[model samples]
Target chain A: MADPRAEILRQAAQLFAQKGYVESSLNELAAAMNYSKGAIYNYFSSKQEIYDAIIIFTLTGLYETAAKAVSEADPPVERLRQFMMAHARFLADNYDCFVTMLVGFSGMANSGLKDDALALRDAHEGLLRRILQAGVADGSFREVSAAMTGRAVLSLLSWMVRWFKPGGGKSAEEVAQEYHDLLVRGLLA
Target chain B: MADPRAEILRQAAQLFAQKGYVESSLNELAAAMNYSKGAIYNYFSSKQEIYDAIIIFTLTGLYETAAKAVSEADPPVERLRQFMMAHARFLADNYDCFVTMLVGFSGMANSGLKDDALALRDAHEGLLRRILQAGVADGSFREVSAAMTGRAVLSLLSWMVRWFKPGGGKSAEEVAQEYHDLLVRGLLA
Candidate 1:
């Protein structure tokens, strides 16, 4: 159930993630896809275009999926936990692609990508903020600074991408559960 | 008093932190220091050399300073809190430099810089890990995975570089204090 273009991005994401944009050449990417270098140009005009596309594709996809997960859940804490688990699943399934886009975006020059990147990040954090705000309004959460607390929680979740190995000791589910419990419920006995 | 050469790196660090490495040119950096481009080259071979030097100088200086702060404290929790506060001050005092080095490191392909970068990170985290382990052993802090906790705490701290505005309403001391409260005491009120 995959589009050919999606297939290309999946591969490109892995390559782009492993070797940065400058280091990842078109010929190598084409060979990985079993196509001529010209075929890549047919899909993407230039490497910069490809990089832009991959970043938007990956980040927008993540935001939308997180939004969907948030909508279908009931309790605010459950919603947050589901969001974390969904994120963990996405990273687990698309490990290299995820890492590549993150590092790429981190190191990219201030191009038009800056606006889009900020917007994407804002949109993703917006989901978490809404949940936190709702919890505060309903007296389910504390009277903390919603923006800072939301950002901190998201930061904690995103840290998984930095250290999570594909075949690490714990499954993504287990890790996500532990994080949610620790962060949301606290360590009070 | 700062050395003349150290002053150059410090100025360059501020520029690189603000404008980014690639966007910043040697001529502008030299001009800021009232030195010609040739004079800068006398100290550094290339812009990349300047960047590498600044990163090593800033992070190593920060690591040593934080280590000293922790050493001057008693009990692991107090030491850990002081370490976090010292780091926050370092980042706050040299916000641009911290942001530049962090964002700059993501894209760098140089093996020498990468090793040093990762090592510097490990050293700081290792210091935290030891404190956390000691706390757990002594029963001041509850049992937890020291490795994951260290990474989580670090991720939370490092994120300040991205969003914290230097002259914002809160001081680094205030923010670091709140962050320490959250990490050590948890959020169960």
Candidate 2:
């Protein structure tokens, strides 16, 4: 069996994603898990702690996945394309986690986790900006502002969480390929 | 003085934007507006009604703005560029309403307004998709999946609400122009 702690986090993420974090209750989460409230407390001190753990875990996973996607020796454009595909794939695979993070980041205030979440986001954007800068420096891409372009592309990719339905339409791979074609060709010098 | 109803909505939008709709309360909204709960009830029946009104108002405002932005008889590519800039400017100008709508749409479920909200979003996306299709048909843009490209462009523009700070760095015009250049150039044949 999976660790009970892991199960708690997983269930909490689902609840948070389905309902906004503020709307989700520890009692409801415990009910969903078929655990007593006391049992839940044995694992997590509070709802905020569960939320923080989920944010930290998901952001770390996302960053590591994106970083590895671009670490290969491919050219800048290819590296960037791979990075985006990896990102879309990760989001599709962990749809609940992505939704939870999106809701949490947008709605959370006066929480210690906000700074960590923002820092993680900045670092993620930083990774994409570096690739854009590399593409420009290598004369493979046009002279666009890396910061703006990076944000635009990341925005295009991240918004998938709002609309992407796993089985309803195009597969994640196809969507990624289409995005790569549309964006990379636009950037080619 | 502004209409008391409009005043209530404006204050509610600010609170909703700052705090998630689920986290915000009618009593807090009334308190913020310096109105008693009874006075607020005269304008809105409940918290959800205020949210629905804001969603309807903002979405209607957004759709009207985008529709007007592209109604001129420019070439399809020019129309598309104009459409994007108009969308970005609207978001920048009505930043709080945009944020409120975003949080409201994402977190709203089992609410009476969900279908209305979804219909409005589809209509908004429909406007952009039509422009993309026109550009493709006229050969002003490369062959591309119009639906996918439209979502991508909309995502890029909509996500701006998350990070755009009015006086922090780039002006709204600059951001709009940058997005136009990056996306339009990508779409050109």
Candidate 3:
């Protein structure tokens, strides 16, 4: 079995994604995981804590994998392509957490949770910015503010979580590959 | 003055956008407009009808505008460009209704509301399909299924409601233009 703490966060993220954070109660989360209230409390102090943990965990893994992909690839365009593939794979693999986080999981909006979430998101953006800056320096990327382009790229990749259905015509790999093409080659034809 | 009926729907959409459908109550909707409960009922039968009407009114206008935009443009790419421009403008112009209809208002899952809402969405997709089909026929858009491409395009454009802030570094026009360039021109250097 998966680690209990990870399992608890997974179930909480799934429930939170289905219902808004406020609407999802500790009771429902426990029920979904077949855990008693005490079992849940043993792992998490409160719901907000669970949300913060998921956000930090998700963002850290995403940025770390992206950085690793960039380091492993030689050319900047290939790195960019790999970055899109990695990001898309992360979302596709963790659809519930990805959708809940990107599409405004209410729990994360709690006043206490916001700062930590944003800080991690800022770190993720820094990773993407570094990749883009490197691409520009190497004559692979077009001239655009790393900040604006970062937001646009992140927004595009994150937006897929909300719409890309699993069993539809294209697999995640195919969609990511197409987007990767769009990113590296652009649409200019 | 705006028709009281239209005014009620408008205010409801705004509130629904701000606070979600379940969270925004009829009493608050009426109170927000300083109208008595009876006054709101005088315009619509119930909160649900108002919800239905709001979507119908918004989607109808949007579909009409999109159809018209695509019809008047010259080339296939230009037509797609026009559709994106109009779609983005509508979303930006009426951010509240856009959000309420798209993400925040969530009554549709198994409710009777789903069919009507789905139909409204399909109508808009039909418009996109025609434009994309024309583009493919004219050798402009890369050969992509109208159905899937339409989904991807809507997913891309719909995210603007969540991220774009007025008076931000990029105006809606600039952002729309950039997206248009991205969608049509491809991202290759």
Pick by TM-score: which candidate is best? Answer: 2
Q: What value does the interface RMSD of model 1 take?
A: 3.2
Clashes of each: 1, 0, 10
* Per-model CA lDDT versus the true structure: 0.75, 0.81, 0.74
Residue B32 Cα positional deviation in candidate 3, in Å, after optimal superposition: 1.3
Enumerate residue pairs that collide in model 3.
A185-B187, A185-B188, A186-B186, A186-B187, A186-B188, A187-B185, A187-B186, A187-B187, A188-B185, A188-B186
User: How far in Å is the alpha carbon of B51 misplaced in model 3?
Assistant: 3.0
Please provide TM-scores computed only on chain A for all of the candidate models, following their numbering. 0.89, 0.91, 0.88
lDDT of 2 by residue, A1-189 (tens): 469988888899999888778889999998988889999999889998888878877787888889988875887888888888888888887788888877667544656778887788788888988888888888888888888888887888778888897777787768888888888665222
Give me the iRMSD of candidate 2, please: 4.4
- Residue lDDT tens for model 2, B57-135: 8887888888988865787777777788788877887788888876667545757888988798889888888888877
Q: Candidate 1, residues A48-140: lDDT per residue as tens digits? A: 777777777767877887887776449777787878877777767778766776555655465667688779978988888888777777777
Q: What stretches of model 2 exceed 4 Å from their correct place? A: A106-115, A187-189, B106-108, B111-113, B187-189
lDDT measured at residue A188 in model 1 versus the true structure, 0 to 100: 25
How far off is residue A171 in model 3, in Å?
Answer: 2.6
State the lDDT of candidate 1 residue by residue for B114-184, as single tens digits.
78877987898898899888888888877777887777777777778766888888887688777676676
**lDDT tens string, model 3, B89-187?**
777777777777766445455446667777777888887788778877777666766775676677677777777765667776677777666666553
- Give the docking tier of candidate 3: acceptable
- Can you list each candidate's DockQ? 0.29, 0.47, 0.46
Q: Higher-DockQ candidate among 1 and 2?
A: 2
